[model samples]
Target: MKLDEAKQKFVHSWGVLGSNWGINKTMAQIHALLLVSEEPLSTEDVMEYLKISRGNANMNLRGLMDWGIVSKEIKIGERKDFFKADKDIWEVARRITEERSKREVEPIIKILKEVKNVEDDSDKAKEFVETIENLESFTSKLDGIVKKFVKSDEHWFYKNMVKLIK
Candidate 1:
């Protein structure tokens, strides 16, 4: 494929993956644009590139910044701010992982852990409580392992995960 085609394919695939990972399509497209662009992009650039509204651009930019995946750059003599992606793959993946864990997993796990502590063991409740406790313990351990694992270098994280899987 030609360079332009390749880039288009990448942006499309990345946008789809981003959707599955809890980000909207235009936001992912904007990020993909920044990822492949040779230079930082201004808010207007992103809005034009993705054909999104200014409000949409601003909101997604803030969301990206919150996840530490994008940052604003100040250029000399330019009143407008430009945005750039986290070019490092590991950092990008790690930040996404951390954000997803905090946004999606933490609350469900907290509720499960709390359920495990409920004191209503009368035969049916006994089984319910026992099962919940087991699941809570298992998920808690897994969450801890994820926390520890994400802190490691990508190579180390993969090595440890491979060994644990084996």
Candidate 2:
């Protein structure tokens, strides 16, 4: 494939992958673009290249910044703001995992804990409580694992995980 074609394919694929990970396609595309860029990109550049409205580009750029994967750059003697991706794959994965766990897992765990605290004596209620308790237990464990993974460097975590599996 031609180089441009390959880059387009990568951007599209990354957009699709982002949807699976709970981010919008445009946000992923913007991130993908920034990732491959040799230099920081301005909002106008993003709008023109992606053929997206200025609003769409701006919003997703801000979203990327919030996710800690992209950041703004201000050049000297220029007023326009440029953006760039973190570029380190390990750090990128770590940030995504940490953000997702905080945003999704923590809320689910909180809801499950509340459900487990309900007062009821019926058989169905008892079963509901038991099921919720189990879910809470599993989620708490998963949260701990995610926390550990986020805290440890990637190499150490993967190495220990491999050792434990064996």
User: What's the CA RMSD for each of the models?
Assistant: 1.8, 1.2
Candidate 1 lDDT, 1-166, residue by residue in tens: 9988887788878889889867898788888988998899999998886688999999999988998999999999999999999999888888888787888768878898777665775888888888888887887787787687579898898897799899
- Model 2 regions lying over 4 Å from their true place: none
- Model 2: ten consecutive residues of lowest lDDT: 113-122
Report how far off residue 135 is in candidate 2 (Å): 0.2
Give the range of the ten consecutive residues with the poorest summed lDDT in model 1: 113-122
What is the overall TM-score of model 1 with all chains considered together?
A: 0.89
Mind sharing the TM-score for model 2?
0.95
TM-score of each: 0.89, 0.95
Local distance difference test values of all predictions, in order = 0.85, 0.93
